[model samples]
Target: MLAGIKSAFNNNYVSAEDQGARPLIANRTAAKGWETFDVVTNADGTISFLSAANRKYVTADLNDHTKLIARAATIQAWEKFRRIDRGNGKFALQAVANDLFVCADMNLGGVLYANRPAASGWEEFTITALSSPNPGTPDSQPSTGFVVTEQQFNQIFPSRNRFYTYAGLVAATAAYPAFAKTGGHAVERQEAAAFLANIHHETGGLYHIVEANKANYNHYFDYNSKYKVVPGKQYYGRGPLQISWNYNYGAAGEALGLPLLSNPDLVAQDPAVAMKTALWFWNTQTGAGTMTCHQAMVQSKGFGETIRTINGALECNRGGGGAVPNRVEQYKKICAMLGVDPGGHLSC
Candidate 1:
């Protein structure tokens, strides 16, 4: 459910119009069946707004000035939005097709358009959760657990490689039941945000599947560690958090019951295995810090500590160059999307 926030159209709710080829409009005085929409979180981490009135997906028609219409039968790029939370109980929908904000154009009789360059009064909308007995239906609200929905994940990393999938991340959570479920709701959300922020930093907004500099590919081998490096394997950075080194691969492989030390490419090839290796480090390893990343958030040690645990040697203190600030900024952005306070001690 979305209601317009433009001064003159504050009371109007988005309506699918009269089905058929009619475009969505923001002139409905009351949010009834036609005004209600199902916020569908897709498996690929994008979101689709399904009109409850006609059971059709809303689409940003690129051929029609990106006018929003409720005529799509299936979810596609044009049907998806990167929902942006404004931290004031309002949000703006950015079309996945054009990376433009959806605007309720008052000058055009409150017609919805995905042509706005930025979110403002005409692009802001308030969402209301409607109660429903059937939880799987489109009208049901999103779950409170984990906090990062597939849609939000897609929103955070719009340009992420297809390999770093949201489904893989969810499946990897099965390995560590307490990964993001340890603390209360807010803590859970913070922990998720912190981990993803670090991952975003490491993978360059999830665009890289492996380390970019090929020169560093063979430099992560450690001979003194208990886990022996395989004869021909190279344990360079891979996956969301870029699990690196021979010992780390050996340990992660042993824990996840995979031949990661020898078949290190699995971390880069298999999405679930890649995510599992990252989670293995988050829940278990302390790296240069004294506590695991999980322990940092669950114990309210702040997001800074998580960064310390992950790469304190290179990125903590004032040694990080721009890395630390980038991670903190990403964390704050994710927290804003989740509607949670990015607690103090933001930087190391």
Candidate 2:
């Protein structure tokens, strides 16, 4: 489905009426920025067909042989092709780049296809009817799940990457019970990963501690900050996870048996503090208290929504913080990459 969509957008196919004819050759010298899909140059002034998946390259030479680029061991026999209309003014053509069947859109510049990585020219074909190893539905989506196998877990934990290990996960689970669980599909891991990915993207990385050498090393807030309006000594960056706002710091400090009001910065440095702060945020469900825009999206849409929200937020704010864009062309690319509906949030 994705390949066909990409192929259509790339203009890689021919109609039934134009049977056995070749596609127009690309005049561009560099393959880096071909405007349409599969718009590759051929040696004899011909062109090669590229797919959206970047697989199955076809050429007019060798009598238009259809061969898999990766394997190159098998050749598809030439056969007569047909076209079938799929309603909505769209047509499904047969024998695409390498005689593959496809239902695609006509190429339009700066459209959805123009935003994809393969937009620089590639051939794509619909192979949904093909069988697979699992044999249930084609699961082409790249899983963003942080749930790693034992071997995978061992590879990431107890070291510089400890932030993703079970130890790091424990704090997140303890702080945000609803979001983080001990077992399978813990919403905590998802939310934490989303949070971490966001902050990392915002501030550089997890190890980029803002208050690395403060007397109150555990807190995240700068007590000496010129903008400090709060009175308490620890009212800077309280709680554990997000170490939210000033008022919430006092409230969380009182609830969690800490001087969160006196030294808030602790949360950003300590994994335990960060976890607790995050928990408080989820538990209270207030923007000032604990909940965030990201949390809201997580509750409503899931990880993808959270990431999209963050992406939009970053793009709109240019790092200054503001309203996020509801629609972005890259979002469609991401949705297509994930094999999900790009029009709305996920059902879960």
Candidate 3:
């Protein structure tokens, strides 16, 4: 479903009028700056159309039945759209508030109106792919100050280089820098290094994918558990960062477009999926706190805070201790290798 949506809308520029008092309309031939929109999926399962012109959200007004406009960057319920596929190349967007589909009045020069009695041909839309705005060309999006060159990546994991592989890391790094540098726990070099270093420590420099104790794999099964183990599947640690347990695998798989709940081995077998799982864990998991590992690193909260954010209960004495110092030391070493000063706050 996500692949379908992303393939259809991810990079296209949306140009439609809002059903507001102003009746916002885009000139198809000579569209204004506010006319273009970029599609982004929210963590909460809603779809957002971010205006390419000013980077705001295409929002619906709850109070005014006919109002829809590009407004806030922060999403609310009104900003969400339920995309209804019409089985053909067409689709309709049903407003969450009134359950009425948006109607694009082609006769009125592409003006938008909603609160219709039912979804009709006028409410249906056929999306067309368009070129994304050149990323590097935008002055507003400055280069993230840190990057891990292939040369540097090779140097970081010398012994387990074969397992992690320079090519695999390069592919992962290239695929994510834009996403990592964009929002939430946006990546700076320091933050990137911290994440990589922790995964290195977790995987013993990337040699280990699945955890040990192959004999007791079935112990992961428990009826009341959140992520119920598959009847014959084992959910141990896998991937670069060792995503252990059933729940972690299920959540990560859902987010990464994989079915790891039944096929947990995918994390250990597919290099691209493995790399993505590590990133998904880092960017989303709050561990023992409100802050994600990425957020903790970039917000100047220090590497130690990230430790607490990731495994404070185990490594910071919340559940157990003995491992905090080693984590701190490893973080510092990686920061040095990356050529960035490990900023303050290095202990849990």
In candidate 3, the residue pairs with backbone N, CA or C atoms under 3 Å apart (3 or more residues apart, or in different chains) clash, namely 313-319
The CA lDDT at 61 in model 1 is 96
* Poorest stretch of ten by lDDT in candidate 2: 67-76
* Per-candidate local distance difference test: 0.80, 0.35, 0.62
Relative to the true structure, candidate 2 reaches a TM of 0.37
Ranking by lDDT: 1, 3, 2
lDDT of 2 by residue, 1-348 (tens): 222122333433221111112232222222221212223222222322333222223322224233212111111222112334544434433443344442222342212111122221233332222122122222222132223223323422223224433455454544455553332222333443444434433333333334333465335454454435355444433222334445566666666677655666666556666656555654454442123434654464543454443343345325423323322333333222221223344211
Residue by residue across 217-260, what tens digits does model 1's lDDT show?
A: 87998999999988988989999889999999999999999999
Question: TM-score winner among the candidates?
Answer: 1
Q: Which stretches of candidate 3 lie over 4 Å from their true place?
A: 1-146, 173-187, 318-321
Give stretches of model 1 more than 4 Å off. 1-146, 319-321
Question: What's the number of clashes in each of the models?
Answer: 0, 38, 1
Given candidate 1, what's the lDDT at residue 242?
90
